[model samples]
Target: MTDRAVAVRTAVFPRDTATVSRLAAAYHSQTESEKVERALTDGDAPLPERYAREIAEPATAFHGRRVVIASVGDDDCGMVVVAATPTGTDVSRLWTTPDARGHGVGAALVTAAIDDAAVPVRLSVWEWREPAIRLYRRLGFEPVASWDDREKMVCLERR
Candidate 1:
């Protein structure tokens, strides 16, 4: 499908559970091995349960966050979660299914998140995720800092 054919829209929590689950799984699978191992060693629940709680419980610190979903035709292809912080909006999660990688689903979701945000938006990506970094750059995000040796923070400000 063409980039123009994708539909991006705000997500409704429990109503979008299936879509969220799929995207969450995709995100989990792509996580750096070190982080995944750390989570496991810390006794965290399995990835699926952790993601479910993140989406379902306000106390999990996702209460007022904004979520966006991107779809092509009837298939949910990607999702993004933007949280309002004291400094700006932060994209906590952004994931696109493998099948949707080249169809602009990630870009569409990020655009929806930024358009709906109330402040400047920022996000962190693994330094090794070159494709995602390129996408963020294309959308006008510039590196603001290095979160660690492995992650770089990027931001997009209102013009």
Candidate 2:
């Protein structure tokens, strides 16, 4: 699907791993940056070491999952990881790069993640990520009972 300046599509493994890994690292960096800002995590380790497994093994890091990529022109700027569970499809790692914010990249990615999902689509986000929560809620996700054990995590579902 294409909207605004963004183009969305399922990521093809190996061929897309380079792009996926790059985005995943950026996502992880943003996460670490947030956690550092909130004092939830320390930046003692190197950036790559902090996300070594994920950056090094995009395919296996999120095993058995579908990855969606969003791009504007030549810049691949957003991604989400989708996986099926007994309950419903779960969405995670949804992110829009810093430079690509507010251009419908995130919405397009969420739409792609849910487009072919089974039954309801589920996702969890950190409570502090108000922008992400707002976007998810705007896209038909509603607050759901906590399904994750992480502190202050907000679970939402769209059925």
Candidate 3:
């Protein structure tokens, strides 16, 4: 299919559990790299690896409790997951493969999440993730705080 014809759908279920693991692994790899960079400069270990370890084996099921995976029809274009907490909606993870960048998949997924957010929504990002930061800005999320333990930044939008 042409790029323009490609579209993203929420609630993605992969044909096999292995595919979910691979996608989750890829997601963790990218985010963990950011965490490692923060660790080197900011003096804390990346938490994702530890977090992944504690959650249990078969990480996919644990992840499903808080996040939803979206797909580009058949291709694994990207995935985003959010958790609605008492404070706000936490955009836990959002990623698009390198090949899917600039194709509106990220924005679409975020838009869907924002629409589903409960009252006020909050999301965190590494200060260095300019593309995601930019997308969040475009989607109406504004910086509200900086976190230390997470080594990332937070943004909020109240609907």
Candidate 4:
């Protein structure tokens, strides 16, 4: 189901590899930018080559992950990745384009992914991303623990 407010259309990737890959490249770029920022903050060097390779060829990273994409009409707005874990499904990635922010794109994508899960959903967000944390909280995800010094893990049980 598409979100009427944002007019977001959600789909499982690989089914439409060409469109999904293009959208995925955009998502990858956004994620890499965030990674670079985090690297700078942590005084670590950014792995440009690795990022490029991973984005150019996503099969390895997406092997076991279920990927979902959101689009507004013909324009891709965002994407999310969920993988089944021992305890539940792990939401490994969620990214929205700048133009898609404040329009429910992220929420739509996340909700669609979580709705398809057979178990609880877990996710980790960078501590500095207050907006994303707030979004997760609003969606009924509770803080479970600190994944690392930089990220906090949250979980949403099936309801």
Candidate 5:
């Protein structure tokens, strides 16, 4: 792994949107993509149409959320969207570039989300994302009743 401790900072609007827009877009693309039967090459992914407006207006899109970017040295590697609630902190989004995987980018992002959170920090991830589920479990998140309506979503909480 790299020697750098992943540094995280909350994204500032207008000035920072351009940089994070691409990352946020990638996150949506990856999450919406389907797995192949066999021998299929990963093609250029199309951004999910539903997120078009959000990507277009991040200033208003993340109205109740916190966009925290994770960087190592000078390069931004991952991001997480957190929202505080009366019961707990909800981590609605977490994403890391493929190149940054296995190097603690995801962990850092989640840790940053938890740093200022209330007693319970919650998140909902797709059932297929085993690696992400493992990472959350390692960070003390346990399976909880889903707060999301999406299919195959597994909700978890850290208290």
Candidate 6:
């Protein structure tokens, strides 16, 4: 008798620290300039140290309460991290490497994150980024708040 193998397509969990680090580095590389940073609507302000504690670390604690979607193909395309909050789901970060733009990966990742959300969703972005703002609007995210000298714009999505 011969043994048989089953073909299954499954999601692979990110495990390598270096891979995560490289993803972070790739994410940062896209934001280091004014054009991209300004597009975040998050003030284009310098990233505070707390952001790393609250956003970057892809650890057990994060995975426990949040859902992360990585739009990877050909390379790491983009990533979205959404954490459950008292009011709703908070989009911690929605980043795409420069190499990943114009590929619809960002939109797909955002959709995945929202679909995975346990509740209503909310996210803050930079106002100067017309493309992102338009994308969020298309996704039903309406403005809820503003911060960072009016550069940061927060949006919400309700059931």
Please provide TM-scores, in order, for all candidate models, with all chains considered together.
0.75, 0.90, 0.73, 0.72, 0.86, 0.66
Give per-residue CA lDDT, model 4, range 1-159, as digits (tens). 244454444444446456556666776566556657766333254446644544665555577776777777667767787788887787866878777787798888878878868567777776666788888888878876455454333433433
Please estimate how well model 4 matches the true structure, expressed as its whole-model Cα lDDT.
Answer: 0.66
Off by over 4 Å in 3: 10-16, 37-66, 152-154
Compared with the true structure, what per-residue lDDT tens digits does model 2 show for residues 23-136?
998888888888788787677856655367778888778778889999999889989999998977999999888778888999999999998789689899999999999999
Candidate 6 regions with alpha-carbon error over 4 angstroms: 1-16, 35-47, 52-57, 60-67, 72-74, 147-151
Question: Which one is best on TM-score?
Answer: 2
Q: What's the ranking of the predictions by TM-score, best on top? A: 2, 5, 1, 3, 4, 6
Clashing pairs counted in every model: 0, 0, 0, 0, 0, 7
Displacement of the residue 120 alpha carbon in candidate 1, Å: 2.8
Candidate 6 lDDT tens digits, 48-108: 5544543366554255544344544335445666667776687746766665666676677
Q: Please tell me which model should have the higher lDDT, number 3 or number 4.
A: 4
* Inter-residue clash pairs, candidate 4: none
Write out the backbone clash pairs for model 3.
Answer: none
Worst 10 residues of 3 by lDDT: 50-59
Lowest-lDDT window of 10 residues in candidate 5? 34-43
Supply the TM-score for candidate 5. 0.86
Q: Scored by CA lDDT, what does every candidate get?
A: 0.70, 0.87, 0.64, 0.66, 0.82, 0.56
Query: What is the overall TM-score of model 4 with all chains considered together?
Result: 0.72
Error of 1 at 106 (Å): 1.1
Clashing pairs in 2: none
Q: State the RMSD for candidate 4.
A: 4.1
Q: Report the lDDT tens digits of candidate 1 across residue range 1-159.
A: 555588988777667766776676667666734355545323344555666575455234356877788899898888888888887678867888878898888888888878757666777776566888888889878776444344333433432
Tens-digit lDDT track of model 3 for 1-159: 236534545443343345445656677777667666667433344545544642334345544434444556677666676677787676756877788788787887787777767867777777788998889898888777554355455555545
Which candidate has the top score in lDDT?
Answer: 2
